[model samples]
Target: MPVDFGPPRVDPFEQAIELGAGRVRRLRSVPSGPAAPAPVQVRLPRQRAGNCTTAPVRRRPVRRPGVPSAAVASEVARRVSDRRPAPRLRLTRRGRALVRTVVLVALAIAAIAIAVSSRADDVTPVSSRSMVVTEHDTLWTIAEEASPSRPRSETMAKIRELNHMPDATVHVGQRLLLPAP
Candidate 1:
């Protein structure tokens, strides 16, 4: 027996008549055994409900009058007008002199403190005559060597008076008389 493998016969005349009469056509002969065809798969298009674009529409920027511009000008004026009278810096001549005197005294005290601190490391105390007037010796150096224990301001004053120095300038090779301790 030869096997028959072909598409099942569909009656087009009967399908047309059934469709015209608005009736369903039932399959009369279904293939059996190995000759039966596999079921076909179909894909249908998906149906959308409404509008698909979900992004919001862009709007024009809003403009307000006398608000942003005045805010900037007011901020500038606020910073400009913040001069708080500069603390009324009224110093009389007496007060100015007092401040100058205090500053001078503080400078003198600091110079003395630096001199003492520098000499604190040296164990031996240098006598007044140990300092020699060399070509490169300055009045400040001479004072420092002569009276290392004394404040620099006092030593400088003593050296100035002893050497009869009109100003702070001292020439090289000039022998200066060291004051007594």
Candidate 2:
């Protein structure tokens, strides 16, 4: 088996010098009529990108197959800086304005509906009665006088429900709003 060694290098200058010196020594011993043709210097044409006359647009090598990782990392960092809220969907200006207007109008509608409903309940019915209390007027006596057909306790309860009174006490000349008999 043979072991392989590295390649051997060759120098044209050494070969030419050796050949010329050998010829000179030989000519000293036996002179020649004419010297052989001298070694001609040859140059190799170097292939280079700079030498291209009409160079094509060289495209940059793709570092990734999909979106770049650096951009993704930057976006994630920006979101995390604000405590990593849920990823927000993108919206155009017109779409954002539309959403804002819709929310505002909905709130206004809710407020209006609440106000109208409250006012609807505030309208006093014609069947209800109001009495001005004289001196020594009590809620029980008034309930009995106001509703002779109904029970005194029941009338008092109805009066309390209507006038929002927690007790049966009444001040002198205090106008009391009573419910229907």
Candidate 3:
């Protein structure tokens, strides 16, 4: 089977209508009445390159009681005499001293608390009971016998430190100081 395609056609009538409509619109827009009025003439003052002219400003005269017209300048001067620059803010000697005192007091309070806690921890009570080692006696058995209230590990550490034992081994007839609970 073979496919068939139609041929394209260009129309001249549509182009002729568009050109005629544009000509008619241009002819109808031409002026149909009298001309407009002429603009008014305005002259501006000539300004020098160095001189600038400002708008006229009027200021009311300041009147003061018992003052002559010539004294107006002095009166204005007296009115603005008290307008001084603002004072700068700076810490005074007394203010600095107060701040230092506050810091010192805070540090003293912290130091006192630390000292009291350290002293309390250093004052571990020593036990009154002592143990005498015999043959084949272990530190574990001595700790159990001397300070039964304390944990076994704590009692062993105390016994080790008090007797200054190099090892866990103990000879016969050795004395061991027991620490308090």
Candidate 4:
């Protein structure tokens, strides 16, 4: 047997009876002898486009014997209007680029501000006294005279650093800068 990939065919008579094609269900009311109210048409919901098979139709609840029709109609209206579609945000390509550029600029400005705010402000003051080398004056004697309370080695290193001297060699009449006492 060949395989079939289509919806099963439904019998027309059975489908009609299932949809209550010839039926008129009336709400219970005082019966008038000669004339009866016209039957209300039951409209089935429309199927989506391109749909091949029929979907099940939902039936409305049967009104109770003593309930008023107006109340039922109001309840249905409230339910139908309860929910609404949420608002959506749609950005075009140019809008997205503009937002990206704004964010990058903001980041750059923030970085620059942080860099400017966090800077070093404590600068060591330059204060020194100049001295002329004399005959028989050695670096040790000069260090001892410059800082009597400090270590001789520390004072000697500081003197050498202040004068940019590589060693303890000094000539007579040569001028040298000494660190503050």
Candidate 5:
């Protein structure tokens, strides 16, 4: 191997200028005075070699066998920026389970809230009247007398449920709350 002590790589612009390849011309004259800052005269190439068009040349990305160009560009950008991809929101099994549980709880709470609100809208004030049990007054007799138009079985069930009576038996002089007639 030859010992190389020069710059690691040659500048393409300087190489072009030395080779007189593009017929580069200065756009403006450089100022020689110290009053203002040094003027940077940009020398633009007249025409690219082997191409006659003045329009900018667009370079196509090299296509690898199985790799896509977009992926390559994204990788290049990431490397150039010296930043790791925003740590992919990776979830472990426990993390996924926690997230799922939270979602389920939220859904359950929402469902409960909806059900409660809907039930609230349907609720009306129930006005109940009290009746004292007599010797002849049984549950069936009271239900029949209170709501004669309604079914006896339904009225009796409601009365038993209201009084928390496991069996259809009422002591004499016992106070009972009857549903609306």
Candidate 6:
């Protein structure tokens, strides 16, 4: 049998009925009856583009008696007068070079810090203690209990070095050397 993966075909008549295509809605403008008045025409003075000589119209200040209105109006005027176009963000060649240099320097410093810290961590003296494994005891649990302050992996490695174990296997009641925190 052939299987179709695309959407099922829809009936055109059903789609049209669902979309209300069969319903005809007729709406007419409000009938202009005798109650409506006719519009009148008025002519306005036109100004020429090049030959314009009229002075620009100015708004008169609203004479408010209180200090608040005067202060608000003055502040609005000051803000409008002091308004300026914002500076666009465009980096110069020198700025781009400086950012690149800073990033490279930071990466170099991070690499050096990682190297120095790894060497520093290796130089630390490790203390060991002998502990007997009990029933249901694993190397991870032993490592965690032994060195609670340091990483479990580091403590496990230290325990393995102290006990000379090949893998992370230990027998119950077996004597093993563990690392101290």
Best by lDDT: 5
Q: CA RMSD for every model?
A: 28.6, 20.9, 31.0, 19.6, 17.0, 30.0
Indicate which candidate wins on TM-score: 2
Which ten contiguous residues of candidate 3 have the minimum total lDDT? 12-21
The C-alpha stretches of model 5 lying farther than 4 A from their native spots are 1-125
lDDT against the true structure, per candidate, is: 0.63, 0.68, 0.66, 0.71, 0.73, 0.71
lDDT of 6 at 58: 29
Look at candidate 3 and give me any clashing residue pairs.
none
lDDT tens digits, residue span 1-181, model 4: 9986554443222222223433543343544557654434333334455773765444454777877688678999998899788779889999999999999999999998877766533433444677899999999998898879999999888888878899999999998777677
Winner of 1 and 2 under TM-score: 2
Tens-digit per-residue lDDT, 80-137, candidate 3: 9968888987889999899999999999999999999999999867668677789878
TM-score of each: 0.27, 0.37, 0.31, 0.33, 0.34, 0.30
Query: lDDT by residue for model 6 over 1-181, one digit each (tens)?
Result: 9988544454222221111322423323343565533332222234355777776322344565655676688999999999999999888999999999999999999999999999998774656568899999999999999979899899889888888899999999999976656
Model 4 / residue 97 / CA error / Å: 19
TM-score-superior candidate, 3 or 4: 4
Kindly list the per-residue Cα lDDT of model 1 for residues 1-181, writing each as its tens digit: 9765543344432221122223433433455556555433222222243753444322333457755665578998998999676777889999999999999999999999999988897744433553446777777877778778998779888777766789877776566767777
